[model samples]
Target: MSEKNERQLRIVGFLCNWCSYGGADTAGVCRFKQPPLLRIIRIPCTGRMDPLFVVKALAQGADGVLVSGCHPKDCHYAVGNFYARRRLELVKRFLPFVGLDPRRFHYTWVSASEGQRWQEVVTEFSAVIQELGPNPGIGADTPMETAGQAASAFA
Candidate 1:
């Protein structure tokens, strides 16, 4: 296979520090085998997640984006996860509208104590991403004007 075809696709993960990040860490420390595709970004809380972050990631060549945070009503910030749920849902809906596959994005909740759950989540999400293969990030030939227009709509 050509080197380009053999390269791994990028999977970006936005994890809440108090819960999902810790859960992921625990999974690592416990030596659970999981896909190494994900690159994690630890956020203070899910409520802090901006929909644009997902858009930018997709536009910047992320094959898939996984957002994991504290379980509803179990968030350390009380209602942060709730807000994240609302925002992420809307983002999911908007994905297809932007000429991007909605399946490339996923959001879920995982608690800090759920290392096994974290392992399962990553494994499942990674499998789906691999199936989808690499993303071109809006296509290399797309005019800058159109890209800016799409981004500005979200702004």
Candidate 2:
């Protein structure tokens, strides 16, 4: 593979233990093809994932972040996914304010049995990031001001 092709995106995924994580594990067991970029971090519930954790992952050089959990009304924690909805909405708004493309982050719901959906999400997310190319923050010392400008442009 060429260097560019070999340049792997570092993605930090926060998956709900009850659903999305299980779905991903099932995908593996079922031998469903998925992008290798994703590095999943399982959480008890989507509600348990703090926005700071997402920010920390970005700061640590992840090219993108994905947060997944049980579908609404399907959370093992009863209503935890609803809480995640509100939190992720705010996160979507704030990431743009911080000069990151809102596209760099994603949130979704997948049931434990949705291995096909899990594969689809990973493949699609990886393709999107590949098209966007490497994160400037990781490859270069992009000033916040510059990133802010880029964000404004994207906006």
Candidate 3:
């Protein structure tokens, strides 16, 4: 592979502890080979997800962000995933407004027992991110001091 192709993409994965994290663990136990690009963060529940977290990841140069939780109503905390779904959707939609591509962020549901499903989700998302290449970051073309000055002026 060429050096560019051999370079690993940086992907951040936010996984709910009750379901999605377990699902990823299960995939590992099953010896499924998956892309090594994802750096997983375990959250208590999807309800705990904050849109700013996704923004921060992208701003800090993550090539992509993936959020995985329980399957809707099947969330261990009952309504957690539902809230997550709504919040993540807004984040995805708003990304473009901030000069980031919506394709760099994704969300999905995976149950603890669905190891194979986790593998598939990771594989697919990883490929998409790899194709998108590294994220240029939020306002990367703008100088930080200039951007900060503009923000302060607005305030």
TM-score to native of every candidate shown: 0.91, 0.84, 0.88
Which 10 consecutive residues of model 1 have the lowest summed lDDT?
Answer: 136-145
lDDT of 1 by residue, 1-155 (tens): 54444778788999999999999999999999998999999999989988899999998889999999999999999999999999999888877666778889999999898999999999998888887778766634566677668767877
TM-score of 1: 0.91
Give stretches of model 1 more than 4 Å off.
1-5, 139-147
lDDT (0-100) at residue 101 of candidate 3?
Answer: 86
User: Would you list the clashing residue pairs of candidate 2?
Assistant: none
Model 3 misplaced stretches (Cα beyond 4 Å): 1-7, 140-155
Choose the strongest candidate by lDDT: 1
Q: Over the stretch 6-97, how does candidate 3's per-residue lDDT look in tens digits?
A: 56689999999999999999999999999999999999998988778887888787899999999977988889998999889988887766
Against the true structure, candidate 3 reaches a TM-score of 0.88
- Give the whole-model CA lDDT for all candidates, comma-separated: 0.88, 0.81, 0.87
Across 29-139, the per-residue lDDT of candidate 2 in tens digits comes to 999988789998989999877776775676577888999999999889899999889988887786755656768789999999999999999899988888766665521
How displaced is residue 68 in candidate 3, in Å? Answer: 0.4
Supply candidate 2's per-residue lDDT for 70: 96
Q: What lDDT would candidate 2 get against the real structure?
A: 0.81
Q: What is the C-alpha RMSD of each candidate to the true structure, in Å?
A: 2.1, 4.6, 3.3
